[model samples]
Target: MIILAATPIGNLGDASRRLVEALETARVVAAEDTRVAQRLMQALGVENRPRLIALHDHNEREKSADLVELAREDDLLVLSDAGMPTVSDPGFHLVSAAIEAGVTVTAIPGPSAVLTALAVSGLPTDRFTFEGFLPRKAGERASALGSLADERRTMVFFESPNRLADSLRAMGHAFGGSRLVVVCRELTKLHEEVRRGTPEALAAWADDGVRGEIVVVVAGAVPRTVDLDTAVQEVLLLTATESLKDASASVAAATGLSRRTLYEAALRARTR
Candidate 1:
């Protein structure tokens, strides 16, 4: 059996009783950071220390097969430095291997910075997407942001403290300066802070520098209505140069309008 356990993002007190039990009872424990796991066990006053092995990003692939084999005979506990395993963590590979091998998999749910940040972001949480981290290079980051410029669901991203300013600047350029965003820093820790403002304002503030773990939530693009007559004329123009299907897709992508609506408009334009 493979048990994917949740570790505290910051506060050790957030560790659940089930998580503590799993940590103490597991025959084998795979952790992102063995040292951190040791410290956590010691703090929790756990007596029996399971055989611990490092299972970070670099070693996950090489070690997953061995771990899954071990899980076949005994309970294996998988944990990350923080939050749930397999979520922006190195546990996905191991989980996949275990499932393919028909091993029983379970989880000990606990605190998560992603949920914590989203709940307090003051942004619409009815629908959202978690973008784990952005590309480090400036050009790659901007290109990534450009693709999401019209995303209507709130977007979440995890970022390193050193790159927060650069990421915010890129967001401002892609999503517009007036777009709303919230930066949650050192979440669930002693110095937890939430800064909310336009991307431009946040970028300016971050220029002075910030620190600690960061989670950013940005508002999605607001949908705008285009004139029906204008949309029909545009679709007609596009169809002259492309197929009806291609024309409708192009119009929808360009105007942020529904593909169905654009196709209907195109049909009406063709008839007229």
Candidate 2:
């Protein structure tokens, strides 16, 4: 069986009893960083000293098969540097390989930076989406955000401190200056901070420099309130150069109106 374990994001006390037990008895452990795993064991006062194997982004694909085979004989515990493995961390490939090989896979759930940030974001949490990380380059990031400009679910993202300001600035441009944003840093740690403001204001504040692990949560876009008459007009205008079906879909997506409704309305207007 392959076991994916969750490590503390920052506060050591958050480590779960199941995770501690697994670490104590596991014969072999694959960790994102063996040294970090060793440090974690030491911090937790776990003296069993399980054999640690290095498994990180650089080598995950190459090592997944061998690790899965190893698990056939003994339980393999997978660990990332922080939080859950394979969540913007190493281990996804291994999990996939295990599933493909029909190897049983289970998890020891615990702290998660994504959920931690989202819970305290003060934004609506009824429905949300986790967008792991934004593109690093300005143009790529802008294009990426542009695609999600109309996303209705609250969005969660992981970011590096050095790029936080620039990403926030790009978000302000793509999502507009008035969009609400929450920046959570060093969650569960002694110096944890949660800052909330518009993307523009946060960008200005982050310009002076910020540190530690960061998670940014942004509020979703408000739905447009265009009437059916206005919406059908848009569909009709686009139909002059495209298929009615294509135009209906395009206008419906932009206005959050029903595609069929727009199509039928436009069809009726055309007949008249």
Candidate 3:
């Protein structure tokens, strides 16, 4: 069996009993950072030191097959430097390989920056999407933000401290300056803070600089009168080059308008 264990994101007390047992008994442990894993084991008083292997982003693909092979013979524990494996972490490839090799795969669910931020974000969490991180380059980041301009569900994103300002600025341009947003910084730590405001407001605050691991949450675009008309026009434009269904989907994504409404509007426009 292949176990993907969830380690504490910050506080060591967050580690579960099952996680402790897994760390103590597993024959092999694949960690993103061997030293960090060792520190965690020391804190938890788990004396058994399993053979640790580094499985970070650069070496994940190359080392997946080897780890999967070991799982076939003995229990192998996969962990990231923090949080659950395969969540913007290093365990995805290994988990995929283990599954394909007919090995049983399970997780010791625990602390998650995504969920932790979402819970305290004060944004609607009923429907939300996790966009792991934005691109490092300005153009690529702006393009990525633009692609999500009309996303209706609350959006969650992770970003480095240095890029927070630039990211907020791009979000303001793409999603509108007044878009509701919350920046969760250093969560579960002493200086943990949640700043709530419009994207523009947050951008200004971030201009002075911010630090620590950050998770950003932005409310979805609200439909407006002009936006409805624009949606009608977009649907007509796409319908001119594609099928009605495809056109409706595209317009709905671009305008935050209901697909059924856009499709009905398209039919009426076509008849006229």
C-alpha displacement of 222 in model 3, angstroms?
Answer: 0.9
Give the per-residue lDDT of model 2 (tens digit) for 222-258: 8788999998998899988999999998777677899
How many clashing pairs per prediction, in order? 0, 0, 0
- Judged by whole-model lDDT over C-alpha atoms, candidate 2 comes out at 0.94
lDDT, candidate 1, 1-272, per-residue tens: 88989998988899999998887787789999999989989988888779999999999999999999999889999889999999999899998998898999999899988899999998999999999999999999999999898778899999998999899989999998889999999988999999999887888899898999999999988765677678767778877778888877766755788888889878976887
TM-score against truth, every candidate: 0.90, 0.92, 0.92
**Selected candidate, larger TM-score, 1 vs 3:** 3
Clashing pairs in 1: none
In candidate 1 the C-alpha lDDT for residue 94 amounts to 93
How do all the candidates rank in terms of TM-score, highest first?
3, 2, 1
Candidate RMSDs in Å, in order, are 2.8, 2.4, 2.1
Error of 2 at 265 (Å): 3.7
State the displacement of the C-alpha of residue 218, model 3, in Å, after optimal TM-score superposition.
0.9
User: Taking the tens digit of each residue's C-alpha lDDT, what string does model 3 give over 1-272?
Assistant: 88999998877888999999999897799999999999999999999989999999999999999888888899889989889999988988888888888999999999999999999988888999999999999999999998888787899999898889889989989988889899999988879899999877888899998988899998986754456667788888877789998899877765667889999988888899
